[model samples]
Target: MNYDIFNGDADGIIALLQLRLANPINGELVTGVKRDIQLLEQVQVRPEDRLTVLDISMEKNSAALINALDVGADVFYADHHRCGDITQHQNLQAHIDLDANTCTALIIDQLLEGQFHLWAITAAYGDNLIAKADELATKVNLTKVQAEQLKELGTLINYNGYGSNISDLHFHPADLYRALLNYPNPFDVIIDTNSPFNLLQTAYQQDMDNALAIETKHTSACLSVFELPNTAWARRISGVYGNFLANQQTDSAHAVLTDNNDGTYTVSLRAPLDNKQGAGDVCSQFETGGGRAAAAGINALAKSDLPNFIKSVESHYLV
Candidate 1:
């Protein structure tokens, strides 16, 4: 069997989309909600199976990776997140770049020689690599209107990945990927009236409106913290809302905390756009946290640790 495993976010979905489009394959699709990064654990690999994993952090899935290799599965892995020590294995083909400006889709773009360049650009935008996406768009001679469309499409597709589980998402990431497969180019997705883009757009707008009405739970010149209820809508919008907050106040770091039913919190941290250096480090201080410098997250943080987490961010970004 052939298996394609990835994070359910825009970068992961689009990265795999580019690969499958370039080299068509029929594989068992393995993915879950955005927070479900440990997808490799759920994949039961056979010795003869081939696996392609993308967008998820290798460090978090390191054990499963070893298991797949031990079973003699040929693995192709690519990501931009923090990966712990990688071992040399004959069956493993790993493409990992930790550059803050790079994402898995862009890495695949280079491998495919830009056959699906516009889709890669959209993934970059969805991952919030805004400046990089815009630069690529311009290089390809895309008009201003066209560039904005890609950005919005990326953002909405990305928004569809957030949620405590698949129940909160408008479309399961796999279904979204299948929907996108019908469009060979990102522009075609924008032009199709019945595409997932329209459904995602309407859903994204509704979530954003609800998010904006919530006042900040904590605020400072250097940091602004917002607490969202333990509702499905809050879980669904937390990540994108953090991106929205970061874009609004380029100089101020933002933290979006979503309450979890078990008295924990799911945290999304974005360093100030003007100084995107401390978020990943800050989140890493906690056990359940991991991510890139510009953005990072804690899967489940104890309620008591909220203050300590906030303090860490303040000490890192504030004077």
Candidate 2:
């Protein structure tokens, strides 16, 4: 059996698209939303079964992934997430490249020599790496208007994956993959019969409304933290909100905290421009999580620690 696991966003879907276009009839394509990054545990693989993991970090799944390798499943993994360290495996051929400034599309573009450069531009912009997207789009002879349209399409499709869970999203990341696979160009996809654009547009509207309604706790002139009463949409809204604020200015940060059902809160942090320098290691103060300069997240944090959490955020950037 041949299996392909990919993220349900534009990049993940398009990366698989490139793979499929290059090698159609590869195998079954597996996918889920952004939150379903831990997708390796669900599959049952055999020694002869082949697996291609796209846009999901193997380092995050070192154990089950290692087990799959030990089971003799030949794997091809491609990702641009926070992969700590990829272990060596006989059956694994990884295309994992973790560059904050780059993404799976760029990796594919690098390998394919601009054959898919235009789509890669859309993916990069969707991932919130606009400068890189434009740099590549420029090389591909895309007009300014075309580049902007690609960016818009990228943002909308990516927004579709926002939501604490699938309930809030227009479709499951897997379903989104199916939708995207059906259309190589998102602009075309939006106008298609089975398009998921309506769902994405609704989420975008809701995000703007909710984000605007919330008040901010100031850390500095450019930074603010907004607390959302944890709902089905909180976890998914944080990244989108962060990106939203970033576009408003070059020096803004949005730390969105959602109160989870378990009395713990899930934190999704984003730094508007210099994400690397902003919120660099603020979450680690609790010994729970950490991320790069521009973005990071914490799995869980005690609600009672709100005071300490505020203090940490204050000290890291505002202080």
Model 1: per-residue Cα lDDT over 1-319, one tens digit each: 9999988999999999999999999988999998898999998888979999999999889999999999999999999988889857999999999888899999999999999999999999999988899999999999999999999999998999999889999999999999999888999998899999888888888889999999999997699999999988899899999999999999999999999989899999998988877687889889889898789999999999988988899888877
lDDT (10s digit) by residue, model 2, range 1-319:
9898877766777777777655666577677656566788878878899888877666566787888999989888877766667878778887776566877767876766666566678888887888888887787788998888888778877776656667767677766666666665556766665577666767777766876788875556646677777666665666667677666676666677777878887777776576445453676566455554566667677888877876676666652
**The candidate that achieves the highest lDDT relative to the unseen native structure:** 1
- Our tally of clashes for model 1 stands at 0
Clash count per candidate: 0, 4
In candidate 1, stretches whose alpha carbon ends up further than 4 angstroms from where it belongs are none
Q: What is the lDDT of candidate 1?
A: 0.92
Q: Write down the lDDT of every candidate, Cα atoms only.
A: 0.92, 0.71
TM-score of predicted structure 2: 0.87
Quick one: RMSD of model 1?
Answer: 1.0
Query: Candidate 2: where are CA atoms >4 Å away?
Result: 191-194, 233-236, 275-293, 307-319
